[model samples]
Target: MQFSSIVGQGEIKQRLINTVKENRVSHAQLFLGPEGSGSLALAIAYAQYVSCEDKSDHDSCGVCASCRKYQKLVHPDLHFSYPFFAKHKDDTALSFIEQWRDAIIKHPYLSLDIWRGYLDAENKQANINIAECHQIIKKLSFKPFESAYKILILWLPEYLDKTGNALLKIIEEPQPNTLFLLVAQNQDQILNTILSRTQLVKIPCLNDNEVKQYLINEHHQTEHAAAEIAFLSDGNLTEALAMLNNDESSYHDYFLKWLRMCFSNKGLEIVDFVDVLAKLGRENQKNFMRYGISYIRECCMLLAGAGNLVHLPAKELDTAQKMISVMSLPMAAAISELLEKAHYHVERNANPKILFLDVSLQIVKILKFKTIPQGTHYIPN
Candidate 1:
């Protein structure tokens, strides 16, 4: 992924290019952002630019032998360490390097959960453990075989456990002409030692315009549809692209239905809906929960006469507006919290059926949490 080829984050790319020009490239840097924000793309592009023999001001020289290798992710000096599931306690990142390369080659915006799906993991947890740290040390011990600087790109360093800390010391002070680019979505979860050693780069999500353009050009999405999807995607390019395929919109529908059901206190209907959600795979279930949260937020804006602040389609906004008319604002707040908790539990591998059922019941009950009439004075009966 060349820097110029990436969609957004012009300032970040310029900063990286300036580093090379100033001859003050940090030995280690962390590209921290939520998924689909082009962090990995920037890392690879920066690596190529540093390695390119005849690089230009704006981008890497794509025709260089070094550039060609990095383009294919076969560059000798470009190493990657990431979370992967092993067959037993012995599984490691090196075991799946080939598959990892292939996956990223196809789509760099993917999540770790997407990668886990390729490894035959059926809802099992994966992480980059201590053993991989030994491998990383061995790889960095050698000098750059071809490039000016050897670059190590660690995707999702948050998955690193205690054993992984051993490699942090060397990452802090790699041999001359070496660079470490650690990409993580959550910085607070990483070890303090590792966090302190590297320069931190914050990559913000793409704006709605940026995402909408990408959809129209790449997915042949209609202009109107692309605009609305971009708004609802909330700066997540991964989710925007997914919505382009139409399958993800089902979650939005489900969310709408669930909200209406809760507002009406339809007990039997919500119970059946919970059963269906419980049967979905963990990833899909998590997605729906996220969708629910987003819709509730939009609905809250509707209740507060901030409809213009919402990103829903005209029809969606109209529908939500009607629901908001009958729905209590306090109840919406509570339901949003319930959905937030459900997403958190889903992330932690909670039983989705139980979680959804509990959440549904809470939503039903929240519908009954009454607000006192404004300025009504009451005496004890």
Candidate 2:
């Protein structure tokens, strides 16, 4: 992939290019950033630039033979390693290279949950196994076939176990013109032995304006819609894209309806609503709860006389204003706690029907009876 194709991270792109320009490209380097921050995309573009036969000062020449191969991720000298669900004892990343290529090419801001959808993964944990480590060692043992450099991009090295030690020697002392790029999220989870052997390339998360503009320019979102999603996404492009796919206005309506039902102590309607929530699928349910939490926090802000800081759309702001009439700051905090707990439980595979029913009752207690949940010590106004 070309650097020009990736979004934002202008400083990071320039820094990576300068490394190639100044001939200071480190052989073993770690590209560390949060998920959805374009770390993997940046690593690929950097590799492409390094392998580009006709690279310009700003980016790679997109029409070159080397650029063409790199763009399709079919270059003989370019290799990839990542966490995979190994069905057989001898399975390596090569077994799923086609799926990997398709997934990455489709969305470079991929998450493990999204990647899981591309595989026949049935509750199986993904890891880079010992066989994959051996395969990596064997792959790096060879010299470059076409290009001047042999490059291997290992994504998510945090999944590497103790067996990762096998690649230590090769990482420390590789053949000339060999580059090892490790793309990872959490620095704390990586093996210190491997961590100490590589140069670090730190990538920051995208800013709100970058995400907003990307949504507007690429996704054709209106300024208000894009601004709301960008604010809610909090620098996660993957989440911003997902939120765009799922209607946030629907979330607002559903959340407001649920709150109104709970405030009125409508048990029958709540049971039906819980049924609707149970069928939303796990991800949607989590997003719904998160939306409720954020909305309630905004209500809290309004109740605390901080309306200037509220960023909700006009209709949602009207609802929040009306909500403040029935819900005080303490009540909003109590409901926020319930929604937050529900979110945590939803992520851990909680039963949505039971979980939502329980949360609804808690909200009823807070909104109707003015009794805060036991753990949260909030006195009603």
Among these predictions, the greatest TM-score belongs to 1
Clashes of 2: 0
Q: What TM-score does each of the candidates earn?
A: 0.92, 0.90
Task: State the displacement of the C-alpha of residue 203, model 1, in Å, after optimal TM-score superposition.
Answer: 1.6
For candidate 1, write residues 1-381 as lDDT tens digits: 688778889999999999988887989999999888989888889989999999988889899899899889999999999888766676667789888888888777867666877777757787887678888898999999988888899999988887767987798677988899999899998988889889999999899899999889878888988887787677888777666655646876787788668667887998899888888887778778777787888889888878778877676667778777766676677668778888889877788778987787666555533332223331111
Against the true structure, candidate 2 reaches a TM-score of: 0.90
The local distance difference test score of model 1 is 0.81
- 207 in model 1: Cα distance from truth in Å? 1.4
* lDDT of candidates 1 onward, in order: 0.81, 0.90
Best by lDDT: 2
Model 1 spans with C-alpha error above 4 angstroms = 264-266, 368-381
Q: How many angstroms is residue 277 displaced in model 2 relative to the true structure, after the best TM-score fit? A: 2.3
Candidate 2, residues 178-213, lDDT tens digits: the string is: 999999999999999999999999999999899999
RMSD, each candidate, Å? Answer: 3.7, 2.5
